[model samples]
Target: MSRLLLLSGGLDSTAIAAMTRPDQCLTIDYGQVAAQAEARAAKQVATLLGIHWSMITVPAREVGAGLMTGTATDPQGPPDAAPEWWPFRNQLLITLAAAWGVTRGITVVEVGTVASDGARHLDGTSLFLEAIDHVVASQEGHIRVRAPAAKLGAVELLTTSPVTEDVLAWTHSCHRANLPCGACPGCTKRRETLAAVGLLQ
Candidate 1:
């Protein structure tokens, strides 16, 4: 059975994609920061991994109304507070990936959501995965959403996922990654997570 991975060109998703060793991968241009840049990174990583790759565009400005949309990361305050959320991004991404999987005879759709993602992202939770699983199952056994890192914290994922420096080289973790603005929340998170695993400077 073919596995369809949702590639985001971020550390977590890239790690998940590496572990899945999927037959093919799909990524979306959600108009997020570094959208095109991340797409380029995804293509690079997918090629390096010998996985077929395709790209899609999501109307993120239309569907996403959170900090990730560039509105405001933290209308409130604190590091792990208001701006930490991204609405239903994972659900939407998985739903689209599952639909594509069903059409391609791919039974498994790999996602990159991790346990530490709960600090800000609600859709990264098991509940959201369960809900999306039902959505895929409703279409029969054609597709299933898989979150390999969902049970693992960022430290565990970074430490144990089969991602090499080569794959990590293809990542664009900065939320404002035109040139990798390492100051953004996403970059900070990635740096901290990797540093926690002793992989970052």
Candidate 2:
């Protein structure tokens, strides 16, 4: 089946995008605080990988999610499952990607969600993707959602990818800052993954 990758300009997604070389890469800007940086990074990765780049701009600033609106990231006290989570974000992005894919005769939708993602957000889980794919399949074409890294962390996922250190540097995972805050979960994970893969000291 034809395929399109949901490129988020994050480490996992960028590595996947580079490794898989989808027909095209789609990045959605839901009006997150780092939307501009995300778009730039996604476009750069897509260009470097020789994949066509497209974007969906829905302006989700009013969604009131901390990740999108630039509030606190993990909140206080115990870790909330919804920390840094956007409401139905992956669902919306998957739906949109599938819809856009259909227009181009694409039937496979790939996301960057990794094994650790489910811990922070609901939609990043394989279970959630299966459910959403089931719903999408009902329509026809069996347009399915696939996360190549759904069972692997960043380092493991990139272990077999062609993504080198320089390419990995193109990612932008900061939730609130245009540049990486280095304190947010995204940055911390980015560093951890790089270190795990022996790319960082």
Candidate 3:
């Protein structure tokens, strides 16, 4: 079956792309603060892996909240919401990718949700994936949503995948800026995960 990966140029997604080598990779610019950097990184990664890559801009900044939107936090968000949490982000992204996938005859759409992601966002959980999968599959293209790395942590995923340090170098996980802020959650996680895999000094 044809497959498409929702590549975000993050540690998890990049590693997943390298491992799975899907037929095509898609990077969405939903008006996130670091959209440019993410698209650049994703394109580079896809090129390095010899996978076809495309990017789409949906311009959802009007509905976005929190750090990804260049905001300090979501005032209307849940009390325990993560700093970078975007309401219905995973769902929105999946829907957009699925919409794009169906026309391309892509039967399976892969995300890079990892084990730790569930702790911070419900959408990253297996239950969410299953539900979304069913919802998407029950429709037109019968496309399925899968998170092949859902059971693995970032470090574990990187270690298990064929992604090398050079590939990892192209990943940009900073949610606040195009360049690494070195303080945001995304940057911090990238540093820690890379260090855990001994890719960082």
Candidate 4:
């Protein structure tokens, strides 16, 4: 069965894509602020891994609720929460992937939500994934969701993933824009994690 990977082309998702080597990958542009950069990096990753790369552009800028969408939301969240928590983003992305799976007979939908990611966004939690898995299972098509790297944070990801160096060089994790602003949570985590993993100077 063909498996689909949600490739954000960031450190985490890119690492998963490289490790699992899925048959095909989907890069969604949900009208995010950095969709172009994500798509570019995802395409590169798919090419390098010899996987089919596909883009699904569904504009959702109107419902913007985070820095990624260039909108302002409640800046005050949990201590571990990042400022870029888009509402229902993970659910929407998974649903989109499941819809695509219906057409392609892909039964597996995988994402890259590390343990630390859950601390940042509630949707990234294992409970959310399990619930979504049930939802997918109930749907007509043996589809199920999985997060193989759900337990690993960035540092652990670097240690475990086969494409750590490539992900470091090619992935983009800027919430402000496609070109790493170096100030956003995404950029900071990437930099700090890379440094911790000894991949950065």
Which sections of candidate 2 miss by over 4 Å?
72-79
lDDT of 2: 0.82
Among these predictions, the greatest TM-score belongs to: 3
Candidate 2 structure, TM-score to reference: 0.92
Native-vs-model 1 lDDT? 0.77
How much does candidate 3 score in TM-score?
0.98
Relative to the true structure, how large is the alpha-carbon lDDT of every model? 0.77, 0.82, 0.93, 0.86
- The digit string of per-residue lDDT tens for model 4 on 2-104 reads 7899999898988888788888999999999999999999898888888899999999877656688776644443555568977788999999999987888
RMSDs, each prediction? 2.7, 2.2, 0.9, 2.0
1 or 2, greater by lDDT: 2
Q: Which of 2 and 4 is ahead in lDDT?
A: 4
- Which lDDT tens digits does candidate 2 get at residues 28-59? 88788888899999998888888999998887
Clashes of each: 1, 0, 0, 0
Models 1 onward score TM values of 0.88, 0.92, 0.98, 0.94
Off by over 4 Å in 3: 73-76
Per-residue alpha-carbon lDDT of candidate 1 for residues 22-127, written as tens digits (9 for 90 to 100) = 8888988876767777898899988888889999986675555444566665533334544535556677788778766787788988888899776566677788
